[model samples]
Target: MGLALQGEKIARNRFTGEKIENGSFMLCDFSGADLTGTEFIGCQFYDRDSRQGGNFSRAILKDASFKSCDLSMADFRHANALGIEIRECRAQGADFRGTSFMNMITSRTWFCSAYITKSNLSYANFAKVVLEKCELWENRWHGAQVLGASFSGSDLSGGEFSGFDWRAADVTQCDLSNAELGELDLRTTDLQGVKMDSHQAAQLLERLGIAIIG
Candidate 1:
């Protein structure tokens, strides 16, 4: 048992570097809050009865992390999430449509950052988002909508991509070693500068009716 609160308004508050474990903040409003370096482990942000989740939209979440948290259907739209970490969290159906993980360098140049490893992101909506040059390994991406999105130069090794659409997004120069790349059409999807292990390469070749034998 941990701290439990429902329908709380914590907007624009600074909870930097704090750790909350096994807590519940169901249907809470955290918009415009500064959660830098804050860690939430084994927490619940979604209200199952009401089918609503905590709102973190427009929040400043730089370097903030969440591990083993129930973030299903959470609203993270337009959040500044640079260097944010979300490991092993249940974030199915979470809305990250306008989340920014990048630091703008110039008008036409920018670099992105975020660590979202080993999480369940099934049915999540990431349409038109940019996650370039980030660490996003070993996560489940089933049924994710990434239309017009770009994941270039990211480390996406060991991910489960059963229902994801490869052609819907830009995944160029990504590290895809040991990933469960379901129906990743080589001809249609651009794989420029992408990295993969020999086993994965063999699998891809097999899809094209080419067999490799020792």
Candidate 2:
């Protein structure tokens, strides 16, 4: 189940339930393709391919830019996505476990109910993204921009967020234990019903018009 296309366009093709594995598609365009329930394992989608609104499962998209594509509900378990720009996609319910998102621009993406455990999201821009109820355990978000993102009811335990911005982000009712939130602006962010330690609570209160006396 492999297709090799060199400098071709694959637009508006309904590939539902198609299994494409171990194929190389260089400079192929997949815009407006209904790839629902499609499985792409060990496939390489090079530049000039806009796969907007496509489904993938256990896809090995290494060095791929499935960028500006609506990949909502795309399952990418154990995929190696190093240096990929999956930005501005409808990626709700996407599974990105053991994936590397280093220097990726995932801005304005929707990852609601997505499982992203042990992923490297360092230096990624997740601005204005919706990640409600997502599982992000042990993920590295160091030096990432998460401004105006919604993480309500999400599990963020053991997540590394050092030097990440949480300004205007809704993190209400989420777990933040052992999570590094250094230099994050939580002033306009909602923290109601969220679980935090005493030191974390004191730090948050200090930002909310509370003075701690020594």
Candidate 3:
């Protein structure tokens, strides 16, 4: 017996620390809903007729799994999303700020324009996924596989890029100022229109065994 939230307006509903497994939340308005410590495993948050998508703004989704759902434009601001799995979903233009996304993986999904600012994404994997034109400011991606992904026009300033192969990715027109590049082999990579200081330039040249002359 699962909780049924189908075709209902459940906005502003506070269901904190509830174990809502195998539930149907289709065509439901979860906007401004307080789902703190709620486990939404095997849940459906999509609408077939309206295509209005689900709204999860300001919801605490710590350890939540939203598998096989259409969550386009879902707002998740200031949410605790640690160890979350959003596999095989359409999550475009999702707003997620001030969230802890450590050990979260979105496999075989189409995610674009995700406004993930001020989030801790350490050990997160977005590789082989084209999540372009995203606003990523002051985020941490240490020990994450960011290669094989195209990151164009994304502000990657003050971000951590340690343990990622930069050669396999296309990072053009990106702001990489004050970012931590931990021994990345950039001998052959598309680095055009990148915003970097002299220190960064020196690091790149040093990797290629090219020393700056005084």
Candidate 4:
């Protein structure tokens, strides 16, 4: 019931500190825009009929947040999403293939940052993305494609990782405590420095058919 603008070209515009609730921005081109500190709550960015979401490719989204937004199938490829927060949103099938959350210090060194907590990232594609040292806790990663992705040193605790391929990505040094690690084969995954709770350890043991006498 808020602002509705579909298929519009709003690229390179600055929308800082604006809050839009229950709005629809389907197929809008927001490329090269600066959306710093902007909040979108309960908004619709995907057009189900046309099967396309708003084009946010290459946007500067520093400190921007989305809560309870339907960003299904949205194109967020190659966006500068540092310090961005997404909480309790439906982000299924969203494409974040080349998003940058890193601040490079040299040619071969960088530290990444972002806060994507308690959101549903089911079926979202994060292939080859570098999200090291970020806060990605309590999110649903069901069937998400993370091939060649590196989530090292990230806080991925309490996540629902059903159908996730652990061997296809590098999750070393990640905090994966209290997460539903579905079908995670330990032999194929290198979980060095990865943290897990006792329950999760037991679950992994049980999955490997190891009987616990105690």
Candidate that would win on lDDT: 1
Give per-residue CA lDDT, model 1, range 40-60, as digits (tens). Answer: 999999899999888999999
Off by over 4 Å in 4: none
lDDT of 2 by residue, 113-194 (tens): 3455555566554555556666666667776556666778888877777767666467888898877766655555567888
lDDT of candidate 2 at residue 25, scale 0 to 100:
63
TM-score of each: 0.96, 0.52, 0.48, 0.94
**Tens digit of lDDT per residue, candidate 3, span 1-214?**
6777776666554566676666777767665566645656556565667665566655556555554454555555555555455544444445554444433346654334344454455544555545455666666666555556677767778877776577766788888888887765666677789888889888889878999876
* Full-model lDDT for every candidate: 0.93, 0.55, 0.62, 0.90
Model 2 sits at a Cα RMSD from the real structure of 10.7
In terms of TM-score, the best-performing candidate is 1
Model 4 is weakest, by summed lDDT over 10 consecutive residues, at 8-17
Off by over 4 Å in 2: 1-6, 46-112, 185-189, 196-214
* Residue pairs in collision within model 1: none
RMSD of 4: 1.4
lDDT of 4 at 133: 89
Cα-lDDT of candidate 1:
0.93
